[model samples]
Target chain A: MEHRIESGADALYMDERDHVATALRDMKAGETVQYRNAEGLRAVTVVDDIPFGHKVAVVAVEEGADVRKYGEVIGRAVVSITVGQHVHVHNIEGIRGRGDLGSKEAAAQ
Target chain B: MMNGTFMGYQRANGDIGIRNHLLIIPTVICSNQVCNRIMQMVPGGVAIPHQHGCSQIGADKDRTFDVLAGTGKNPNVGAVIIISLGCEVVDPAALAEEIRKTGKPVEFFDIQSVGGSVKAISHGAELAKRMMADLEKQEKVPVPWNKLKVGVKCGGSDATSGLSSNPALGAAADSLIAEGGSIVIGETTEIIGAEHLLAERCVTPEVSNQLYHIVNRFEDEVQRMGADMRGGNPSPGNIAGGLSTIEEKSLGCISKCGKAPIQGVIEYAENIPDHGLYFMDSPGNDIECVSGMAAGGAHIVCFTTGRGTPTGAAVIPVIKITGNKMTFRNMEDNMDVDVSDMLDGTGSLEQAGDRIWQEIKEVAEGKWTKAEVLGHQEFSINRIGPSL
Candidate 1:
């Protein structure tokens, strides 16, 4: 569980299992940033200008797929998402405490 | 750091208090004005005025009585003055008797019995002045750090809250527990999505079951009202601050409890047992949560907020912590410590935790927090049922 701090690192990898990384600073579109996860050092280009404290998709997610942050399911994708895309309420839907757990049930489809 | 002690007022009941306050409490809402007037007339008198003393039945009325008694029993309060309207559901004499068990001075008066508001105010003020003077005479002695009970709370949370401040607070919580002190983390609403994580840490299966039961009961209450808990939580401010769901907010919220095995689960405003970490079933509202902790005998409170809030309890000092650098700078007057450096990699989590631990000792040693210095004595009781 080592996270290498490469040059120009702009986001924090909270946990190795987390599929989403948090932007430590406001990142510009197309900017490259280094992140260290359990798999070792890697880089992802920012497709959107992610605001500070916001999440970025470090792994591509399909529509209705669960989104993992802090190694727990924070929500599920409402539509297909790609790596480097900003992940938020616009493209993601919360699964926890949902009145219907519809997304969890929908994930099986 | 683990073996340190702080100067405190050691009460006859064997409880240690960090602050020696003369508390003026109103048994019913109808007596709020009289209590406030008494407080204004007497210097060094603190009053907690709230609604819901009349027309409350069942558990709701019991909660009001419990909170009032528990607050007066808080070790920080050196004495208590009770004001009643003489016809409220909560009897002033009964309330005074409950708090008297703590061996602290207790006095009571009724507006109706006293003849009118002016007479009641005058009578209450004179009693408060005498009590304040008497409390000031109490001497402070050295008390072990482990004897201290502190409440951990987070309000107006943001993305940075869980990431930096809350974990830092958790570390401090662990430190306190390791030294044999007690730390109680509350806000059942905030733990909606994170209950499983806490349940996994309970010392016994029964404790875990209690944890789940409280969370489920709260959810059921929300459902009974024909509303969704998610819609009200992660409030608009939380969303703007980058919290998208209750799970996300909860993941951050639970970090403040640290890694201690939960010793037990207690009802809101219940007496907080000494030692270890406990969970109090309470609301997410800042004032109400802090109020319950105070009533539960918390000598001090460590409140972490990312968006910043100026909330302090009537009987205890609240030390505010924030992880958002922007918020810390903008609300410097309200914030006590800033761990924003952890976000930019300028500081480590352990350092942030140590910083909070240091602030706790300083406050316990009679140092005033930003809220205390600003005179933010906010107090509000959480209600369970509607008024009849």
Candidate 2:
């Protein structure tokens, strides 16, 4: 994926396939932030107040669908997420190293 | 620009050391007070007082013994004085013998045979003063970059760690590797979902399989206890800093090692080879991981943190780099490098990488890291088995 190092962007999205953009600063609800991705620069209006260094969804995600970051799957969406919503543990759950799920779904498998 | 060389003390066994430290080691918990007292009485003396030395069996005892011997053998230490209680499971004589193989001055005695802590402290102090005087006579010679071995680690991570500091440190790691220096990356428990990426980068199938084996071993142990790594992996601070999953954290964590192909996978506290990149199997606990790296012979450590930590090692310098502007500003005394500008668009990734690389070069050439200046000589050993 193309990575351009330009100035003055509000959020940063690492890959073109990523559904979320990390807020570079504390962002309030309804504020549109610009970011650069493989497809070129784009803007998204945040629906939730996202804190600095937090993730904000750039596209709508269906529950149980994989969420991508750094061009790889980071976790699975636990709940349907709308564009510009804060994407974090509240909405996403990790699928690896879940020994609490019992031996059937142990991390080794 | 400075030349790619640093002034280093040349040891008797031909190993180059950046620091000429007089180390005092306690063979058992019973001798800790005496060692500490001796360290206090003598100038330029460092003491390591640990909890393990007795009641450990088999592999556990072996690990403790290896770490103690390895620490004493580190090129950073010029002379070693080992104090034992004489009743501990760990053998002080053997430990001193292993260190003496380096051809450095090694002295060992028992508090029991020396007639208790008071006399032991006085005797140890006298030996340490004499050793320190001799170490002062040693002169540093010009050493090439290839003589350096650095350990890359990340802790108290935040989302910014992945976005900035980690990748920046990765660039520094790559630069060091390009210069024929060595880099070792550990924290097997943190590399859960990202093991495949690292495994694919292994130089051979054997190394790749070993990477998978270590990951599976950690997972099996977690499964045996019916405990989920999630309950502790991202940790409360990590979650508050916006890291949601171990997969995300691991991806960022691995980036600190750069893109060097894995040469081999070694056990925790095992001696790191003289050159290239190696992966050591170690836990994610900050102190234990750093200590393991020190025992493995890392001359220095480049640590990236977003939430910030003041952790340092007893035998190595830990250079702290952070990706959060606020964190760096708030903890400037502890942080050595700030690469947070990558997030705000004020700096490019390459520029941030260069910044870290420059810091590493300077630190290698006798510059003190913030952790060292603050006297944070934290040490801990990773245990594999229960104490008997």
Candidate 3:
């Protein structure tokens, strides 16, 4: 069972068909986990869920862009998220962008 | 006329229908049981039981009245047998008179006038059977694809729906427009953070302003209730299913209407006129949304979802499609098409669109959708005011 993230998609998608979900739950840094779609061997997906789909939260405030899943922004890290740390509402917040924010046109109406 | 060419009754008001049946229309709640009893004796009859038609004032009452009239005027119905419990604000005879203008036959009886439910049912059954017998005699004609008006709807959406089924359905909606057909997309509340995207697509500034205004009206109502949309619509299951924000949900929601230049915006459940794309202001509740479209004159609805809901309408046929592979696997009984290939890369968006378009054509030609086959005829009119 292989699932690969599609190209042009914004999410750092993790396809979990071949590997165990627990591996993503327990694995630490320096472990090279692979992610594959039908495109056949694109790139390795780091086993992480919360903050970034990359390595777990490591630093105090991450500087990288927030990773998107399901085509919507989930959370943000002021600095880089290192491997194996709980990423919750405290670390990340809703996305702020043009057309990405709550509608203002109707708010006044 | 060519034999076996997708037959539906040719209504007197110059419309064609894929289904030919006499409907039992109840004017008030007091007459629902009597309507049901009449349906027991007639096989090809439908009963629409609603809690409206009394104590409703102003726009609230008018909205209910219009929907009932639209249901009666729907081309699918060959005739209507109205069952009214006397002493209601809604005049059954007046409703029957409005339906008669469509040239479809109508008959009405009041339970109070007939002395009770039993007598009314007996009288209604006779009228219904006679109407059905006449309806059974109406023949189908080869309707031009241009006469086809479809509603594009999405509900129980998750993140994947925008990426898969919704976009794929958008493709199909574009195809329908290309063939000179019309499509209407509704769910005003669901449009939340993305009404501007849709407003930009409107063909005119007035239409765009209408879109903006509908969203505003909905927001005002929410504030009046001392609640925000974030508290409802995008349920907890949607969050767990991979949705992050209502804005995220809305971006996905709008995809069901392909990239056609929107011709106009319409009120909730208002009749769709002419060809091309339209926006209907409505809440995201699936049943009420579907009802709005049906009452607005859509012959069928293309409903896409990732959360796998089993809902259909009493009058319109709902074609269900799914994008989540797990949902497809688990809810095969409810789902009609699978676009999981968008995720797995087995199929292209065009392929999925073509498949759905073919299904729409076949459904228009008398093929029963899974919803209809499974008897999922759900109906709920959006009540704008408190149920006083």
Clash count, one per candidate: 0, 0, 16
> Mind giving the per-residue lDDT tens digits that candidate 3 earns over B188-240?
87777677788888888998888888887876666555443443656766655
- For model 2, residues B1-388, the per-residue Cα lDDT tens digits are 2366789988888788988899999988889899989988986788999999999999999999988988998889999999999999999999999999999999999998989878998899889989999999999899878979999999999999998999889988988898889999999988988999999999999999999999989878877777657659889999999898988899878999999999999999999997789999999999999999999989999999999999888988999999999999999999999998777767877788888988888887789999988888888888888877
Per-residue error at B18 for model 3, in Å? Answer: 1.5
The DockQ value obtained for model 1 is: 0.37
Give fnat, all candidates. Answer: 0.28, 0.62, 0.04
For each candidate, give its TM-score against the true structure.
Answer: 0.95, 0.97, 0.84
Any idea what lDDT model 3 has? 0.71
- Of candidates 2 and 1, the better by lDDT: 2
User: Can you tell me which runs of candidate 2 are displaced by over 4 Å?
Assistant: A1-4, A104-109, B1-4
lDDT of 1 by residue, B1-388 (tens): 5546678989989998988888999999899999988888887788999986899999999999999999999999999999989998998899999999999999998889899999998888788888888888888998888889999999999889988999999998998898899999999988977899999999999999999999988766654555434557878788777787777888889999799999899999999999999999999889999999999999999999988898888989999999999999999999999998877777888889989998998898899999888888998889988878
Candidate 1 local lDDT, A1-109, one digit each (tens): 3212343457777776787888878889999887777676679998998888888899999998888888887878889999999988889876544544333244234
Error of 2 at A76 (Å): 1.1
Q: What is the lDDT of residue B161 in candidate 2?
A: 91
Q: How would you class the docking of model 2?
A: medium
- Highest lDDT, which number? 2
Best by DockQ: 2
